[model samples]
Target: MCFSASASFVGSAGIALVGVATLMQVRTPRTLLFAAIPILFALHQLLEGIVWLGMDGRLTPPWPQLAGQLYVFYAQGLLPVVMPMAIWLLLPSGERRRIVPFLLLGASLSAYNLWFLATLPTDIGQCGHSITYHNPRTREMLVAIVYVIATCGALLASRRRWLVIMGLANLAGLTVVALFRTWAFTSVWCFYAALISIMVYWHFRRERMARHVEEAPQDHHFPAGNGP
Candidate 1:
């Protein structure tokens, strides 16, 4: 189904809310940073939608255009930087060896942004009749591929099986969206907005699972006169 500007905004708002709620599941060192990634991503799409509605096209003019461009660049690039840092902090000291692959993956994706900026024309007319400067669908497909690789690398290294499953599922979904090219809307922005909304829902489900575990009392007995 096609999404109007208001609907897009509402979807982003839900995503942002879910991201924020996910952060509250625990006060881990990585929680805020990791959760913020999705929120920023959701907001990035929301702002792009607002700009599209304002400009009546994808390649809007002036500040909003630049702002959206910058946001996308950072979201695509910096998220990798931050995700590895979060995973590093969460990993056990003995498992520090696992961090190498994640670092390499994140760095490689971050480098793609630099290469894209250097090789691609940032000129206004390069893309037209749409809300993005480049062919957004093409760009998004590439970004999804990079994320698939990076997250897969992380999942493989992660001791947690759930992370592997979730990472694989995310990779599969993004790959489908990229390859099939049959989205609910013609607008690439709308497709991303919808895709990210599904991701936000998945994050919420994870948060609920975390809460359930936290609420459940532990039955293990500690040594007498000693406590955790």
Candidate 2:
């Protein structure tokens, strides 16, 4: 999937449209973060396109380096925390307890990533037509385990059906990415997750439509207007 900049650009454009639509559907703050997922992914992909261009020597230096750094910053440093926190925001009070632990863990992981990203340089390279991003600090076995728990765990713990479904989808994708492209985990997995993010729109759209249906006025017929 990391074949070329064109793929990344085209994918980003499509995602941006879906992302905008999803944002338009948001009616409350609780859903705003979740709904913003698609657009965030769109931006992420767009950044990757710039990285691809830079990597391919079509773009100048510093720009590509900057793009790649930003990409890793979001995918590795910020995403884990956002995933669980977004899930937590969508869950009801009763359902929130299940998500809190992941939220805490994600926060920890994000903090760790931020520290490492600031202190260390993320090494980027090409592997099997994919971009590989590596931060020595984040590449530890324990960190990978915790990263999964923080992101996917919260989604799975969610009572919301769409979130649960998305969680399962992400888990399945994660397994494949883990098995096949471990070196490109950060890049490859994020690409898959970007596609998965479209469900964010679908979920919000379904929710908004359901709300509309519930709020729609119901007609009641009187028995031949007897009082009149």
Candidate 3:
């Protein structure tokens, strides 16, 4: 397998594990939304693997082009909006207000990017050890800034320590990719984000266990039919 394929496979496996753990404890709409992130990311990684095979000549003509476009669709068209929206949903109502702007920005950007993707051509190629996805519409600095804010800002604004850590890790990864490997930003950063998603599973599982512990004593003190 190629570097891209290898990386994508590893990422997909990690996210799949997180997805299982997430499913085990999801108890609310917000938790469901949060749980979906790993599955979405796993799909994203799998699509990238297809793109890799396409680029490597392991797949036929139009297939590579199609795979490339699909990869771009997720990286540029869906992720900005999905990331912030998921984070916003996971936050408390009071804290959610602070993330509203990010969610709105992400939605607007995603809409525009999806339109751009539909009308424009996307080019994908291998660069050094990563893949570079080219779409002229997404090259502007303003878009870059807003993309960061929409994706990273929501995570950073979270009251959860784990989410904050994930946000900081992603921010640092994005900064490094932007500065040193701008061409491979999408590929590299997605991998980084997928790795950090493990923290999300940890956060959810820990919270669920803590809640169970808290409820155990209460359940013991107050029998099913007893009331003060």
State which candidate has the highest lDDT: 2
Better by TM-score, candidate 3 or 2: 2
Q: Choose 2 or 3, whichever is better by lDDT.
A: 2
Instruction: Spell out the clash pairs found in candidate 3.
Output: none
TM-score of 3: 0.89
Q: Supply candidate 2's per-residue lDDT for 158.
A: 91
Question: How well is each residue in 1-228 modelled by candidate 3, as lDDT tens digits?
Answer: 127776777878878878788777777888677777777778778888887877767887777678678878888899999988888888878889988888999999999889988998877888887888888988677888899999999888886788888888889988988998887888887777777777777878888998889878553465478566
Better of 1 and 2 by lDDT: 2
Candidate 2, lDDT over the whole model: 0.90
Give the number of the best model, judged by TM-score: 2
lDDT of 2 by residue, 1-228 (tens): 388899999999999999999999988888789889999999999999998998889999999899898998998789989998888888777778989999999999999998998899889888878999989999888998898888899998896788889999999998899988999999899989999988999998899899999999999987676564
* Stretches of candidate 2 exceeding 4 Å from the true structure: 225-228
* lDDT of residue 125 for candidate 1: 25
- Model 1 residue 63 distance off true place after TM-score fit, in angstroms: 3.1
